[model samples]
Target chain A: MEQTAQSKSRYGMVIDLDRCTGCGVCMVACAVENNVAPAEQKATERTGVTWLRVYPVSNGEGFPANDTVFIPMTCQQCGNHTPCVSVCPQNAVEVDPSTGIVGQIPQRCLGCRYCMTACPYHARYFDWWDPQWPEGTEVLLNPDVAPRMRGVAEKCNFCHGRLHAARTKAAAAGRKEIAAGDYVPACVESCPSRAIVFGDLADETNEVSRLSHSINTFQFLPKLGTAPKIFYHSAKEWVRKMADRAPLA
Target chain B: MRCKGLILMLSGVLASLAIGWFAFPAALYRTEAQPMQFNHAVHTGEQNGMTCDMCHEFTENGSFKGIPTIAKCTECHSAAIGSTESEKVLVEQFVTPHKEIPWKVYSRQPDNAYFPHAAHVKRAEIKCEECHGPHGSSSTLPVYQVNRISGYSRDIWGRNISGLPSHPWEGMKMDRCVRCHAERHRDDSCLDCHK
Candidate 1:
């Protein structure tokens, strides 16, 4: 379905870099929630599919002076001039106008990797091998999220299976909108430090919206004008500067 | 000789059309009988007056229960209510054995497609007959035909080999869904329906 109308709710996130411990709990939660199979024996860092990845950046100081900051990155969910959506020849990448969330349809993907290359954040991952789970572990996979087959590109869609469930619950209760706490992503819920603040950025009263506009909150590669919904907040000058620069480098 | 050649070419074209329309569908679909024949008319008849939702209900969380289990059937058919052979078989084979009936769903979609029955039935007030035709009024369950290659029901592709719908309720293809959603002016994204 083509969503031509402007969305009322723009779902976004504000991640506090200072609070993130880089424990990789969010990554584990994301994998389990989305039914992302564990990496095959032959898969490497480059080949493995990780919806969320943590990178530790250093202060570039000697010994005791050196400090590290962990940055958790996923799909930025570009609002304007979305690079992946434009480059997808199969029309697999889409920006959901209702919730303002970017979605990837793996069934429609032709494994072209055009969307992967178009994404400046390197968020999209191509499936190098067929999905495999440890024996007796297949039954533990989340039934809501369908396991994607090989030869397709996949990435974070903010735990859309949970969103679907939330919507279903709302519909059952004779409501149109889902409750605020009904649709939290796996990463945000699993965060021990509560570093991630997620909500409708369009809603002025929302904490995520407030944090997005707050001082020191920045988006990666803002100059490119992709208008990413995911925002990063940090008090340090170098951390903010590093976020403003190309995230890949 | 030119006239003979033209006739021969026309014959070839006609043969191809006949094979494409008639023979292809037969070769493509494999028909299998349902485990048991269910008479919906009897259940929804004047005596019983049971509605579709009475059996095929939505859970409290709004997930659709596509088919009722043996428990639901046993509530009525604990011991053959009628002298029908099907009822006797249901009691002895399934209900008595406490085994779930292996019912083949006709409107079963792929895992990627997320169809919310609650949104359609409860919110929009769309009758079950809108998509399922008159299954509630049916005297007997129809044979389930599955495509050999795609493993999808023949109902999804519709009865027509040309991909044309003979009835308004025919075919549950993406285009059919899009057409309905477009008519309703309900704008949706890929994630809304496809998980």
Candidate 2:
């Protein structure tokens, strides 16, 4: 592999808050695709590995509450700099050059869980037990990846496996780059509402990049310099206001 | 008189070299004879046609399968493979009573090292043999031993300085990671190697 340093992969996402119903399809798909172990069934705080979490925001009306909004959360893969990437001791986490994908290598990780603490979104998770599957469920295991072990830490890899698989197929066919249609993160593929868009930001023709500059588009904590690749889009003024910090009273 | 002195000098050097060779290996070799001689080659061999994933299963969620339970063993051994002495033991200890074998793991990561086999195997298209050698070639039963102090296998730290296992049985260690990382121009920050 000729090492291409920052080959303008321009990884980015656009979440259409207008269409989101807070259904949580992205969360379920993320867990299943990434092999996030079930920790607790009752409260999300306990069991499930919700990679793309949905947050409910109130419209701030009193008893006759006007409206509510759903915001799906995930590793923003902040560009320019990410807090978790800098705080990580083992370099287990990285922002890959080709895909702008954030990579987490489990074998290289020591489960210190520092990255988890650094993120305000709480995207990272720690493995509490050795992964177990219900009997007869072994056949359902994905043959492409390693199951995580107990006493380790884990988080989203942005479905980098799928991207690599796509790239590999492209390369095998004597192509130098991945087709836009050939790759998508599991959440993006499984979203029922079509609220999520994945694409290369550097490609001016890309839909995601175009929507990123839309009047409704916004990034979380942009002032912090995280440069999150995931962008939220909403037509509601209050919802868009909530996407960034609230104006000082 | 000079000849005698030379002979004494040569003898002293030879004695020191011998001590260094034996003492170093003796101190380093943490192999404790395992309770069983489980040969991966026989189990994974084509004659048996055993797939590595059969025992090391992974879930769609990307979690790796662990040591099978007694029921998993009874899935096949319930009928019994009385062809050899090892088979007899397998039947008696695990099959008859439905007891799980206390197989020692030789390739466990540290408490902090997060290794998910599914990501590499299913998503990365890595083969089992890439990390574990040809386990199907051995006919003997496997034995797992741990370091008494660290409660881990010696291979976790790697014996050879070069990071390549001097023997196929040698497990992956931190040294192996550092060596590979250095070659690939990957991260080697303490954070990268430690966690």
Candidate 3:
């Protein structure tokens, strides 16, 4: 695969909403893999941490015609002037130039909710309480991912821990490029329908990149010019129209 | 009245400072002793010809084995070879009972901190002594001080009361790690070190 310095790829994911079953496997997998803290007893959807949440939106019709589409949403990994990265007063969030991954430094985050306000996608979740995995589940936690504390704002980091693991393996193998199969995100890996495809969009050979260029593909809030790396593919015209809603002034 | 108000404010400041700098630190860390006084110089020094990895080894999958297990010590100290009290304790107390030596690690990072020794030691080629200091050549293990507030060892934040690190490896605060990463021109992605 002609992997070179000039070809440092922009990582992206093209998720097929058409194939999605509205199942919460990706959500559970993301929470489990990332050690996302549990919600408080009186927690709401607004406060709970879901790194990759499946948002089920309706077609806005009566019972006969009404249909739901499950869109898996995450950090969006915006490229040009990333909102969360720019708005973070503490410099806690950063878009890594090498991987095109938007990383949140929980240790550095002051839990001001500035990044949470900045993100239009609502991917960022603040830990309302200290992370305590259910009983013995703590031992089963993926050791590669460190659990964030209560006051830290956390989001989908695209399973950067797994990426680092793959990189380490590649470095040991004396290979410069991480094989695409070796670096799938928790959400993408967990999806039963293989609805989510993650890879370097800059690389033409990568399947996700190819899928991204398809006419059916669309990004959320494209008019905002955030230029998110995630692309969603849906055959339904309403879903395509629903993807690029204008950001509120 | 103004002078009295000033005195009150001054006393308040003094009390806070005392709590932060003196009383808190005194109350913060609880002193604990290691099961055995380990002489690193004896094992890793030239005469014995033993290596750090020979005892504190990595798992087959490259995860660090934090402390050397009792079996490792039994391999060499099957009987009390050295005529020292600590060696006698190691042999009789732990080795005889086949108990694990609770060697309280001075530089053990918190659960939130995910440090990959292989990435640092093998990939970056950083010497163990660089981060661990002269621990390998030290005669005895230092006192284990556990912070009451954060439940972290004082060595994690460094033994310095002022938070001003005297040596390169003294403190392991996030900034120190960032400083080192910046020096190496490595990607300081939070997950890169934190996980």
Cα shift from native, residue A200, model 3 (Å) = 1.6
DockQ of every predicted complex: 0.53, 0.06, 0.25
- The candidates, ranked best first by lDDT, are 1, 3, 2
**Per-prediction TM-score:** 0.96, 0.61, 0.87
lDDT of 3 by residue, B1-195 (tens): 999999999999999998999887888789988777889998888899787788877664445676788999899899998699998998999999999887777887876676766666655667888888998899978888988787778898898888998997897778888898777666456666666
- Candidate 2 per-residue lDDT, tens place, A43-139, comes to 3564455667888888778887669999988888878777788887977788766566676667667888898888876777777666767767767
Q: Which candidate do you rate higher for TM-score, 2 or 3?
A: 3
Fraction of true interface contacts that also occur in model 3:
0.26
Higher-ranked by lDDT: 1 or 2: 1
Restricting to chain A, the TM-score for each candidate equals: 0.95, 0.90, 0.93
For model 2, what is the error of residue A86's alpha carbon versus the real structure, in angstroms, after optimal superposition? 1.2
What is candidate 3's CA lDDT for residue A50? Answer: 91
Candidate 3 docking: what grade? Answer: acceptable
Better structure of 1 and 3 per lDDT: 1
Mind giving the per-residue lDDT tens digits that candidate 2 earns over B1-195?
999999999999999988777765456446667544466676667767778778766554435666666677687778766577667777887779877777766677764454545444554455766566555466663444456566777556445534466775465866655664466564333322222
Q: Give the whole-model CA lDDT for all candidates, comma-separated.
A: 0.90, 0.69, 0.82
